[model samples]
Target: MNLESLVNLAGEAAVLATGGLLIGMAFGGFAQVSKFCLRSAVIEFSKGLLGSKVAVWLLTFSAAVVSTQAVIGFGSLDVTGARQLAARGSLSGSLIGGVMFGAGMILARGCASRLLVLSATGNLRALLSGLVLTIVAQASLRGALSPAREMLSELWTVQGGPSRNLLSLVDGVPQFGLWLGVAWLACALWLARRARIGYLIEASAVGVGLAVGAGWLFTYSVSQVSFAPVQVKSISFTGPSADTLMGLINSPSLTLGFDTGLVPGVFAGSLLAALITREWKVQGFHDGPSMWRYLIGAALMGFGGMLAGGCAVGAGVTGGAIFALTAWMALAAMWIGAVITHLVVDGAVAGSVLAEPLVDQSSGR
Candidate 1:
């Protein structure tokens, strides 16, 4: 490329990176402030306490679905363009990987996104889990386990293009999905208000949804106008963690994109929050057994994320927002996996389902 072309490329990449960073930071801050974790949601739900956390989770998703559909309706994006929402959706990957991801999150005491935030807050145990999760996820994506990944994906994958989303199934009537989301959001809001949910919880949940929606909008905008080959995507920690690591180690040959910017941005945002809150402190494992458990948890999460084609955030939240079939499948499978782990491993998983409003993280990990 010529000098002008190189400069233009750099400028475009910068813009895209900036958007990704802002999105990541928003999510990081929201998650940190809210102590948001799918594992926590499952645990609390299992305990029969349909608390504010669950309200936050459902509202966040409903908001995302509504916002995402708005973007698509405005002709700014297409759900089918998303790799995860592509024509060929893998059922096996969703089922097996989701199950593993759920169990792993419980074992590690947090999901992939939760660990990332915790790691930034100087939790050495989370740091270790994050590292192992990254390595194992990378292996599953492109390393030793890639063959198995391919085999499973191919074996159970089905034609999902035509029915990838509600809009597509309804032949471009995105209003249907939008209305559906609105109805869900209305119910969520009613429940949240009835429970007297706190402002922080509601704001954080909505903000996270906006962040996810903004990611799709920004990436779509960049891909639409940028001359360079840019991949359109939203947030997902598993692949992005690997992509970021590769970009860091091989900057001369590697081109940093949305993923590279996002992963570090999340860490930076969480780090900033930790610093401001005076929560940064070393927290390594207390014993070898605990360390081994974390290691195993990381491996399961990594393999499962790759097999499922995305982690909790990737599939459950991002893909689910767009109404992807695989995402819903994975979300259910992951939930089942968590329930099983809680029943068998966590011993009865019994607790009262309190009707508390979603509020602060007074009782969180």
Candidate 2:
């Protein structure tokens, strides 16, 4: 539908919400089928095993980078005003928070987006952990934990604009971002081929990337058409999840926007996919220790995501696709943290007969 038609039909808020819902559904479904999880990829890589998990993650990341850069190269999108690049960002927060988030995901057995997806697939452990994550996220964003987040964010700040944009650093290179994406895509393809990944899985991984690109395009389009100011944003779960949860709890009337619609849309889409594939089965924590581990992980993710300004998918993929400096830093920090945590935590209990499984059964490992 044209922009004018959409605005006239349900107003700006509705239009944004609708766009988020559609994009979120695509991401959720593709992610479910592809078994895309950053934690898994990190684990596989840390163990020196370049397996299907790593291939799927590489494909998804490369796809997002390629598609988003392709649009920018074609002059269809301008992300200069996006929060990741436009606003003052924190280097300290990105590093510290990224590490925390990585370690947290290792313990939780999922990232923010993965928890939401698993919750939809009848995983009670995920559902509970997701709830804790949301509540803690809300607390971190505006409640008691906000001060700590703010303090970390202020430790080292970079002014927005060209400084935050990676492409801007390499001035005069025509479509440098696009070429970078292409290189990554080539690597992803090579890895996928070596893993002998099926076409359907590969396509689904690409779909996840396309969904991220669509989010950028859709929001930008809405901003152009709407009379009011609209933030041009793509997929990210941290702030959105907190906003959604708070809207449900405190607001008399929920604010209608991209974030308000994203969480639920992802949940619904994942649920649909699970049911269709007969993957929907109730699963819960197998023991008290496992339950504590999940809750602790959820808490860490919530606070860390808020402090870092994004979660695994939020900062790592969505922001990284745009070549935001802090996003890349955060992504690197996450890898370091995940690898270290796996080696220390998982390795500590590796030889124990009573140690919990390395991969959660419900994660489709």
Full-model lDDT for every candidate: 0.77, 0.88
lDDT of each residue in 166-277, candidate 1, tens digit only = 4566775637877888898888787677767788778777777778888888887777667776677898988888777766675865465777678878888888877777
lDDT of 2 by residue, 180-294 (tens): 8889888888889899989988999889988998999889988888899999999999889988888888888889999877888899888888889999988877777667778
Q: In model 2, where is the ten-residue run with the lowest total lDDT?
A: 353-362
Give the distance in Å from residue 193's predicted Cα in candidate 1 to where it truly belongs: 3.2
- Pull out the clashing pairs in model 2: none
Instruction: State every prediction's TM-score relative to the real structure.
Output: 0.89, 0.97
What does each candidate score in C-alpha RMSD? 4.9, 1.6
Candidate 2, overall lDDT?
0.88
Q: Give per-residue lDDT, candidate 1, residue 178.
A: 75
